[model samples]
Target chain A: MVDVKSVANPLFLREEELRQAIEMLFFAYRDFTGGPDEMLAEIGLGRAHHRVIYFVGRNPGITVSELLKILRITKQSLSRVLSHLVEEEFIIQTPGERDRRQRLLTLTQKGVELERRLTADQRERIADAFRKAGADAVQGFKLVLHGIIDAPDRERFDVSGGPTHAPVARVGNKIAGDKMPGTKIAGIKR
Target chain B: MVDVKSVANPLFLREEELRQAIEMLFFAYRDFTGGPDEMLAEIGLGRAHHRVIYFVGRNPGITVSELLKILRITKQSLSRVLSHLVEEEFIIQTPGERDRRQRLLTLTQKGVELERRLTADQRERIADAFRKAGADAVQGFKLVLHGIIDAPDRERFDVSGGPTHAPVARVGNKIAGDKMPGTKIAGIKR
Candidate 1:
C-alpha cells in the first residue's frame, strides 16, 4: 500500500519543477500548433484563419455572435480572419433568416477541404498520442484538457455526431482498433 | 465477447467531432494562459516577457544562447524581451566566467517575486485540475502532452525539470495532493 504520510509537503516542492511545467506548456503548445501553422502559412493564413474555418465547418450556419462567444475574441479580431476566409472562398456568410443583422456562416467546399486538411493532421497527431498512451491515459488526457477549459466553454467540447456522443457498444478489433491497441472493444461510456 | 464487426469504422467518424477537438484545444489553451496573462498585463509584460523571466529564474546561470534554444525563438525576438528584463533590473546579466562573450542570467529578488506571482496562478490552476482528474488522469495527460512536443524538443523538455522533479513526497493540499472540493488539479507532468 502506498503510504500517504510519506508524501512530501506540497509547499516543499522546488520552484524549478513548477517552472518546468510552464516551459513544457510553451514548447508543447508551439509544437502542437506547428504542423497546421506551416500549412496555414503556405496559404497566407494563420492560426486565426484555421479557427474560423474549423468552427464554421463544425457548426454549419452558425451565427457570428455564436462564434464570438465560442472564440471569446473581439469582433474586430474575428473580422480580420473572417474577411480573409470569405475572400478566399473558404466560408460563406448569409443573412440570418430571423435577424438580418446576424450573419450565418458555413464552409464552402474549398473551406471544407482546407478544414479537413488542417484537422486531419491534428487528428492524426492526437490519435497517435492516444494510441501510444492507451485507453485509460487517453481518457485522462481528455478529462484534464476539459478541466483546462472554462466551465461554460466545456459544453462545446462535445462533438456533434462523434463516438463521444454515441452509445457504448463492445466491438472487436479492426483498423481503428489496430491504431489504438489495448482499448476495450466496448465503447467508452464517458 | 465483443463483436469486431460491430466496431465503428474510424473512417466513418464525423468531421464535426474532429473539429470540436480543434476548438477544444484552442479554447483550453487560451484559458490555461489566461491566469498568467492577467498578472503579466498588470506589469506591462506579455507572455514573451514572462517566458524570459521564467527561464532565467529556472536556470540562474543559463546563457543567452541556451535561452534562445530553449525558447526556440530567434535571438532578435528574444533580445527585445531580454533587454526589457535587464533594464528593469528584474534580471542581472553577468559576464561568463570562462567565455567573455557569453552572459549569464540571474533573477533579482524583484524578479523572483514577480515570477512567483505569475507561476503561482498557473500552478494553482494545474494543481486544481490534477485534483479534479486524479492520479491516473494526470499521468495520461502528461503522456499526451509529451507526445505533442517535437521529438528533439522532448530532450530539451527534460532539461527544464518537469513535475517528475517536484518533491513528490510532499503532502500538502497546495501542490499535488490537494484534496479540496471543486479545485481543478489538471496534472501536466513535464
Candidate 2:
C-alpha cells in the first residue's frame, strides 16, 4: 500500500521520455528502412515489395498465408505485389511438398542476389550497432524491443529453425555468445 | 592483424542474429504503430496524415521544411496530406513572428484531441516497456535505436527543451535519472 498522490516522486513515466521514445522509433525505423526503400524505388517497387522479397528469401518454403500473416496485409494487396515480383522473376512459387494445393514461396538466384544487395547496408548497420553496444546492451536492446511487440505477434516473431532450403548465406559467427569484435569481424573482407 | 579466412572461425556477421534483429524491428514497429494506424484509418486517413499531425503536434509550430525534413517525403506528397489535415481543421498554420514569410504549423484543439487519442497507446506502450526494462535498459534501448538512425537525422532526434508551448503534459519523474520503480509514479493512474 503506497500513497497515491505523493507530491515529489522519483519513479514515473516522464511524458517527455515517452514522447522521446516515440520520436526515436520514428527516426530509427525511417533510417533503418531508408536504404532498402531507395534501392526498391530504383526498380519501381516499394516497401511492400521489399517485405515480400525479404520474408520469401528468409523462409524458403513459406506459404502465402504465412506471409500474409507475417506481413498483416490483404491477400489482394499481396496479389498485386506478388504479380510484379513473379513477373520480374524475383520470386518463384512451387507446389508445396506437404500440400498439393499450397504454393510455397522461394526467391530465385536473382532474387537472392537482389535481397542480399538490398539488405547489405542494413546488415552492416546492425552489425556496427551491435558491435558498438556490446553483447549485454544488444541483449537489453532485444529484450526491450521484444517487450514492445504485441503478445499475439510475439510467437510469429520468435520464428526459429533454419529455412527448409539449403543455406543462403555462409553461417557467420555466433555474435551473441562471442565477443562482438566490433569492426574487425574475421572473414573475407567486404 | 587478423586472419582473413581462418576456416572454422568465430567472427563474422551472424546471419541468424541479424535476421532476428530485423524481424524484431519489423514486428515491434508494426505493433507499435498498429493502434494509431487503426485510429487514423477510421477517419479515412493513413500513416502519412498521422505523421503530419504527430510532428506538428509534437513540435508545435514546426516549419513545413522541418516537417518535410523529418518525414523525408516529397513536397507534393506532403501537400496532399497537409491539405487534408488543414481542410479538416485538425491543423492551422500561422505566419512566423520574425520572418512572417514562414508558415508555422500547430495542432488545433480537434487536432490535439485526435493526436492524444492516436498516441495514447504508443505512450502507454513505451511507458510499459520503460517500466519493464528499467531505466538502464531504456538507455541501452535508446542508444541502439539512436545508433540505428542515419547520421544526418541524429541531431533532430536529440532535440531538447520542452515543446515550445505551455505545458502540453504534466511533467512526471525523469526516467533516465531515476531508478524507475517499475510502476510507481506521481500523477496519472492506470
Candidate 3:
C-alpha cells in the first residue's frame, strides 16, 4: 500500500500549499478543456452539450437520470443539451428493455464522429502528459486526483478505475486506442 | 532526472490512460469548483466574476490587457462580468501611473471579503487533498498539471511557478503569508 502517513500530517496543511493546488487546478483544467471547448463552440454547442455527447458515447445505453447525476445538473439543464443533440440527430434515445418509461441514450454515427473530432486533440495532450510524467509519477498523480474527489464519486472510481499497476504509458496508449482505445472507463453504472 | 523519458515513449501510450486522465480532471475540477460556484450563483455572480475577483485580488495592480491574457476571454465578455463587479462596488479600476491609458484592476474591501468567502471552502478542500497526497505526490501532481498547460501558459507558469522541492504543507502555510506570500508561483509577469 502507498505510505500516506505523511500526507495526513497537519503540519503540511499550510495555506500556501493549498493555494498552489487551487491555481494548478485552474490552469490545468482550462488547458485540458480548451481544445474541446473551442471545437464545440465552433459547432454552436457549448461544454454542456459536449458533456452529454461524451457520456452518452462512452456508455451507449445510459439512461437520462444517470447522465444527469454524472453531470450534476438538474433535469431541466440536461434537457436543453440532450434535446439539442436529439434534434440534431447526433444522438438517439430509446426505451429501456426492462422499463419502457426509461430513456436510454446512445450516440448516432454522427455523434461518434463528433466525439472523435472533439477528443482527438485531447487524446494527444493526455498521451504526452502521461509520457512525460512516467509510470510512478502517473500513479502518484492519479492518487492525488482521486483523493480530491468527493466520497461518492470516488466509490464509482473504485468500481470503474482503470487497470491497476500498468505502466503509465500503457494507459495513454490504451486511451488513444485505435477506436479511441478503451480508456478502461466503466463509466457510471446505472 | 525524473526519467520522464518513459513518458515520452510512444509504445506505452494507452487510450485507457488518457481517458482516465480526462475523467480525473472532470471529476476533480467539478468538485473543486462546486462550492464556490454555488456561492457565486447565490449572489447573482457567475464563475467568470469569481475569476476576475480572484486574480485581481491576487495581483492587485494587474492591468486589463494582462487580465485578458490570463482569462483568455474576449474583452467584450470580460467587460460584461467586470462591469457588474465594478458597478456593485466589488472592484475599482484606476489609470496606471506609468501608462495613463492602462486601467489597473484591484478588489475593493468588499471584493476582498467576497473573494475570501468564495475561497474559504476551496482552501479547506485543497488543504485536505494536499494532506492526503503528501509532499512527493503533490510534486508529481503539479508536474502533470504543468505538463497539461499550453506552451505559452506553461512559460507563464515558469515565471509564476510555486516553490521548488518544498514540502506540500509548507505551500499552504506560505500561501497564507501575511500578504499572499509569494510561493514561487509561476504567475505571468507583465
Q: Which ten residues in a row have the lowest lDDT in candidate 1 chain B?
A: B181-190
TM match of model 3 to true structure: 0.78
Return whichever of 1 and 3 wins on lDDT: 3
Tens digit of per-residue lDDT, candidate 1, span A1-190:
3224324444544443345455666767787788999999998999899878877776788788777876888999999999988988999999977779978899999999998899888887777766776656666777777777787666544322224445465343232322222211112212
- Going through the candidates in order, what fraction of the true interface contacts does each contain? 0.57, 0.54, 0.56
Model 2: residues with Cα > 4 Å off, grouped in runs: A1-13, A156-190, B1-13, B158-190
Q: Give interface RMSD, every candidate, in order.
A: 7.4, 8.9, 9.8
Q: Which run of 10 residues does model 3 chain B get worst, by summed lDDT?
A: B176-185
Task: Compose the digit string of candidate 1's lDDT tens values, residues B1-46.
Answer: 5533335554444333334445566776888889888888888899
**lDDT, model 1, position B173:** 26
Rank the candidate models, highest TM-score first. Answer: 3, 1, 2
Query: In candidate 3, what are the lDDT values of residues A61-99, reduced to their tens digit?
Result: 888877787899899989998998999999999998877
Q: Compute the lDDT of residue B32 as modeled in candidate 1.
A: 81
| Candidate 2, lDDT over the whole model | 0.73
lDDT of 2 by residue, A43-109 (tens): 8999999989988887777788878887888999999999899999999999977578988888999
